[model samples]
Target chain A: MVEVEMNGTTPSVRDELITEIELSFGLLHKAAANFDNRYISRVFRDLGPLRRKLAKNGDALATVIDRLYPHNSASRAYLLEVTGKTDESMDEETKSAVKPEVDLYIHLLVQVYLLDNNRLEELNKFNDKVIYLLGSYNRRSLDFIQAKIWFYISRTKELIDDLHSIRPALLSALRSATLRHDTETAASTITLLLRNYLLCHEVNQAMNLVEKTEFPENAGSSLVARYYYYLARINAIQLDYSSANEYVIAATRKAPQTQLAVGFLQAATKLSIIIELLMGDIPELQLFRKQSDSLEPYFMLTKAVRLGDLKLFEEVLKKYEQAFKKDDNFTLVSRLRQNVIKTGIRIISLSYSKISLKDICIKLLLDSEELAEYIVAKAIRDGVIEASINHEHGYMKSKELLDVYSTKLPQDDFDQRIKFCLSLHNDSVKSMRYPSADNRSDINKHNLAAKEDEMDLLKAIEEGDLDDFMD
Target chain B: MSLQKLTAELYQLYDQEEYEKCQKILTPIKLELIKHNLLLPTVANSDSKDKINDLKIAERILEIGALSSLLSNNYRGFENYVAQLRPFYSNKQIHAKPEKNTDQTKIISLYLLYLLSQGLVSKFHVELELIYNSKQYNVEQDQYLLFPVNLEKHLMEGNYIKIWKVLKNDTNLPCKEYGHFLDTLVNALRFEIAKSLEQTYETIPISNCKGLLYFPQEQSDATFESIIKDDLKMTGWTFKDGSITFKNDDDSHKGNVNPNSINLISNVLSYAERIESIV
Candidate 1:
């Protein structure tokens, strides 16, 4: 470590990290004294660059601790011990008092450093101490820091493939967060627990938790988006495709529109495509084109379903079987086999008003006419297509198309969209958070300062709050 | 009786094939378990080996409750038991490792079959997603699990012939309990086929129709017609000249006015009024 730092190239990078840490420490002190979270938010705005630096030179964590803690403080000793580095040349003028916010922030940095370095076992061993410290603090300003720290903790546990043991700690944290009205921590814990449950395929428990708990209305948008994503996943597995479609749509909408969130967008969009296919609706081609990442598997899948080609669907499933399984959409995609045949039958009925069973077999690549007859019959029964079979003649005749103007299909479609828009508006109004410092007397100054603060939080969210989508 | 003594007796009764007596004793035993805090494994009580064993016994009792209800023709009770057993199955303490051909897999598979037989394919798929992904249960290789999984596949593909073979061949059944659902499942399969055949054919030779519905070759046409009409409610069929012809009943309802047009008109008028005010 000393030899690496002695090099001219690395010393400048190390010095830059120390300067940033000192700046962050000043921000933390101001936030702790004024009880203003915006300062902490300011500190997090520069977290992306700081995080990269620390992950490379985690030894800087030792420097931050020594600078922020008095020599005899337990936090300094514990943090230095965790970092496994000691500073013997600390001067008397360098020591500062430790705040819980600073303590937790330093721990958060260590977590990110360990994670990026692939030192999961050390991180795992280090979690108990951090959790104990977190339990001792009851400050509201620590809520955001607590929330982010728990995310890293759960991430470490998940990486170690030990998902169950963290449930007790997370559930207790959720209870305390809610009791203290710590919306950020409560929201983060709920999402972590839901992710844990879904990871183990415990849909029943996840559903019960969702039914029991009321997610804080004023939770951060990223956490809310993740909660919705998990809900969509659970509902999709439970075969509620319509509700699942709505949730996935909400998830994609709520997700941050930044380069950092492209992974989440692709995942949410992939799920949206599958649910749409299951609902017997073809997702627009633009849906696939929206993702910068190659959603080649889903694109191919939608094409196969659109063309009503069962063989192509099979080939795609076979080819991307591992990818689908990795995304945990394998079972849902496997369920599309029936949808493929239904679409095939639908297309055949549309193209030929009256078609023989044998021609249907050949077109569908069916083994025998008997198979095609049964499939078309099932499709009709499932309301996938409007056609009747002539059993003795072994031919199917498409029912005459209903008058589009007279039928209620168009009306129902319009009604659903209108209702959706109304509900979305109602939900937004319900969850709107009023600023506590709303003062009409000095409107101009307050508005300007509020806009700046809002932008800072938004910027911080864009830069450092892709934590929920890390999974 | 002590809870242990009662549990012992229940086990004996289960072994002796006395499901009724076992069910009667099960009610008090569950209450006893609730009294002892061993009903559902929790973090506090499930810490020790003894409590875990007790919970395992509780799980076993619920399994018996589920199986006994099905065997005794109390389907609603069976469903309730399956619901009660879910937490126990999901508890990490009890199902730490995968077990093969145990009563748990059979009970879960039975519930899957129940869902399929009830025509709740959506619910079946939901349950299937959980089972297939859970590390504790191997859906593909397990004997009891594969039956329902394979049944759903063939049913979705509309290969009723494969489903017929699955049902007809008793060897395909993993346990005797599955035999109870055979009649109902066959009836459901026949109903599905009958609906399809009616829509697919104007007239079908009686013998071919009989074969499609899985009727015995020697059964009289009168008997087949009575079963088809009464059971499947295929009233649109008429038998003549060695063939059966379908009467399309949907023709009468065609061209009917939309039932909700008045509501639609009222909504449109309200919208117009609101637009006028805005203007």
Candidate 2:
């Protein structure tokens, strides 16, 4: 038997084939630029002609393979089978069932497949081919195509630049795209730009753009809600609590009851808790926290204290400790940690005479003796703890430290209120007098002064003072 | 396991003069790492690759180029990449844009600078800086590798060198096409600031720093009392104040949402425009 091996394809032939493929790709790209649904449907219809022409070709698959990968001498076997031209004949039934150009269709299908499967390696190769083909265009045409790509990719910075590159032309294209019910382009372009604006901390530009954009009539509920949700986030980041809350409410109403929207709502609620805390509105903070898993317990604890409900405080604190371990990083979450340390001290010192201030300090692991003393002094000044010279009952007891530190650190309008707390404590207590006093009167005075020294050393209270300098 | 560990291994390969080994390890994961959009500081740089020849490291350095584009917050290199991917991902209506060489250079350079400054590059920043600042390194005369550092240094200086040096270097530098424009920008600013500061130095009082820092012409309801009593109640919220004051409308300034967000946006836009003037 004579063996007849096929010759390998030439480089020039491969180049010619690649050039034709590129021309086809360029035409497809131009068609997509219209973004007209009717036009797109018509184009799909027009492709039927090519499909018919491909069907008439006896060896369509092999012909296409030769055109696409002629240099790959390894694909001969696969090619023959694909094209129904194999000399090792298949059964008539199997041959009839196989379709021409199946491989061509599969190659096209692979683009979507690789993207869906996160097979970026294949996708990147495809990208390189397209870039090589399109990279030779003029400047204006280049900008338009690049803009569309960036818009679809949700790569915001490039999207913004591409949008601005030829503002009049880009904007006109976007407007026409929207008119044609290309909601995907409209939503993706606007959302990506908004996200970039937010990332760069450019809230106003984002807000301005967002507020000006009207939702398309047939816009997906999810898309509408997402847009509003991001707008709300910008508001929240800016500390516009009311506006943030309002935008979230609007989003909830606009969005369908889907998991994505629900997730957005949860994020919005977290923002609300932070805003409420800043506003000195503990009750509202708890109310908002109920919607978010992360902030709920912390807010509930604060709510219990603000309402002066001891039972509620103990119940929530117990659950909180179970949920948040003492060593957990979240236990030290700034806002909640502030509430826990201050409120725990305030309630125990003022209301519960049985637990010593020192006992409360131990509960909180506030072993720093300096902190204990300052907290005690702050409580007395706030009138939460009475400043009495009597050592046995009300005088410098360890159990009472918890009550003294419980109040919300007042800010802005309440700044002077904290200062007032500090000054009052300062006036009532005697300064520590040292250098070895032997006389009984001197020793008593020294003890009084030593109590005052603890107040000066407390870190949290000093933090409250330092707050003045910060803003 | 962790990027820190991977980066450390990469560093080890780098240090052992195993450039190909390091490249093999990194090349597969580079796209995935870049896709995460991690900030440069979080990317660990190992010292291992330093033992290899610089040219060997250069091959692996392209991964940094790809990564910088991927991780750019501004998506600087993304357009080029996306343009390539157009046929695969794009519908019939969309096409890849032909990228301008100059535009590509600026973006690629900017992305690299951002990456290098944030410590994301495979080699240490000091090495890049050394390569950048070398007197023998003339960007126009050299290649793309040398161009980025020169552009950055020239940008920082925003100045013109002596005429002979300028004439010699001009043909090599990309900025020469714009006519040594950065010098004009720097000179103009220098002249303006000098003229104003000179006047202010003799006449203006430096006593009121707070007033100088703030908008002196505008009146604010934020009196010291309101600031102290209403705003600064130190319970972990002063940071919130800066954000809030911009949006607060009720008691702070009822019926009016502060346009502070707009101010910030406008300021950034102006700064970007100012930077554009040099390039």
Candidate 3:
């Protein structure tokens, strides 16, 4: 041990204790790295005595250290690494630099352990510490570090199933990114924030965020895909199948063709199939085979839906119930039964120009003729089939198909596309950066120059210097 | 301040419905308890007498904290406290049970009601499965848990009238907090009933509507009519002296319809022909 003179220049007891803690942490790191359970327990067992020693020395750092490393055993290795340079002789700048790193490391290590053990309560405590530390640090210039911390915090909230808490964390992350002019990370964090809102079934909140937040026109493809995927989910939930289908298609088209993005592509495909089925359109079989075994259940669901086989649909749902439940798509799949019946009715109307309500009841497995008539009438009124229900004669009449391209529907589709583009353009215009308050002086100087030019012109005219003006 | 005093103040604030203040007051005490590893009774800390009492006090604080969060609609806070209470409830070594009326069953019932009101059916089932697998309580005997269980079953089976009866006739809602959720569930059931009725009938007599919607006899026909018109937005309805007629729009559909569905059929037929040719 290096001995120091016992004088006023000697290090304080708190500094001495910090050195001891750092030494202990170094030892703990080796034990943890080697997975030595016995040594790990010994290090944990030693923490209390060390804490007592600091308290006996009348050092306030004991309480600070205790607050920082609440679960000392779990965060021993990280704390040691973080506070390695915490010596009285160290410069203030070095201490400040190391403190943030320590704070970040402690949070990351605690998050790892909490996630590993599923200790959500402890994770929430750690989350509060991170928020408090970030507030105290107020290092807006360290945008990447701030974004990383917020990302981890939001991810932890998600892991604990407290999805509602993710919005504030991500919003702060977006704010940090925007403050540093890091637009890429800002866009990505905004996408993640929107996804959390969608996951929480807060579609209005998600839509509001999208409308209020300024997304760069040149956002990353993956982020754009995610944005569209979430938008599609919101639209699907709101019963706008056509708009949902369009969004999912856009998501699929822009989705990255990487192995890591396969999950996103698969999810987009599933939603697309569901939306198409809901809209009474059959998804191409080729779409289902893209993901192979991962999408097999969806393929079967699509098949059942295409054939309009309600029994087959039920069988498929039962067969894949566990998988669907695990994916949280069981409820969405359950709604397909109604779609199956509607598809069957559409098929019947297409096959026959005229069909009796009694025949429809038998063909569609209806409980009564009145129910069949009601279903057929609703289908006709809904535009699912171009047919008329003759209530008096109890027969349905399907109209002959006109020219396929002869309607104003295509113009309506184009108009919708134009409106969407216009909205996007408007959003970009709103997001455009303008000169802030700092640039106001420069603007004032330019205005002053123009005023001087006007005064010169007035003086020139008043002094009969029109010859100079003409020249 | 002592933890006991702070906890008392927290309860007072919570009771006064100053939830945000309760959160602020509890933060320091909670941090201290956590720092000392006394927030919950763990196996390691169970032998210490002081810690055992501290754990009991901490649990009460957490319970009140959870209630305050629920009352304030701070779901994340409520979830965090409930999650912290889980280890104490589930760990066999720590036999810390909620005292008397502030039972775990009531808190869980409120959580279930929150899930129900949010229409988070999957999460509701997941939580129900977790409780079932934990095997911690006699679920059937607990009137609070049984309310959500029976309500979910009735809702799933489309037994709206039975659900209405449960809301109207069931006097024991476990606590006053459940009354708010009960009203929400009743409204959801009413909406479901209205949707199904709209799908099935173009015209229904006003008196028949009363029984279908479970309108109390004391509620006037005009009240029921306004609820359908204003709340449900069924503007196509006309109420005469004794009957209500729903205007049928020829172009209106009950569910989503693909404008290009005809083209979709033609495309499917073409694809089938191509597949047949290849095979």
- Output the number of the lDDT-best candidate: 1
TM-score-wise, the better of 1 and 3 is 1
Candidate 1: TM-score? Answer: 0.84
- lDDT per residue for candidate 3 within A201-282, as digits (tens), equals 4555676787888876665456667778887776676566788888999998777664546677788888888888878788
Lowest lDDT sum, 10 consecutive residues, model 3 chain A, at A462-471
User: CA shift at A412, candidate 3, in angstroms?
Assistant: 4.7
Least accurate stretch of 10 residues (summed lDDT) in model 1 chain A? A1-10
Docking class of 1: acceptable
True contacts kept of 2: 0.00
**Per-residue accuracy of model 3 over B134-187 as CA lDDT, tens digit each:** 336556667778788777765653445456656776575667777767667777
TM-score (all chains, Cα) for each model: 0.84, 0.29, 0.48
Q: Model 2 TM-score?
A: 0.29
Task: Quote the positional error of residue A95 for candidate 1 in Å.
Answer: 6.4
Provide the lDDT at A98 for model 3: 36
Candidate 2 per-residue C-alpha lDDT over B1-279 given as tens digits, one digit per residue, 9 for 90 to 100: 555466667767655656546546665455545554321211132223442222223323443333334443324444444333322221111113422343333434444444444434322232332223333233344444445455333322212232214334557555422332334333333332222222221122222211222223343435532432353232211223322111111243321233345644765575566446435
lDDT of 1 by residue, A304-405 (tens): 999889889999999998888888899999989888888988888998999999999899888888778788888887788888877767888998887777
The residue-by-residue lDDT of candidate 2 on A1-471, one tens digit each, is 001111234445535443443444443444346332222222233233343333333233344444443333333354444344554433333222211122223333233233333445444455443333323322222332332343323332232333333333334445654565556446645655665555444455676786787655444345556667677666654445577666766666565443424555555454444445433345454455455566666567557656544456567756776443321212122223333344555555566554544565565566444334334443443334332222123234333232322322222235455445555555444342333444456546668764453334332222211100100
Error of 2 at B94 (Å): 38
Rank list by DockQ: 1, 3, 2
**DockQ winner:** 1
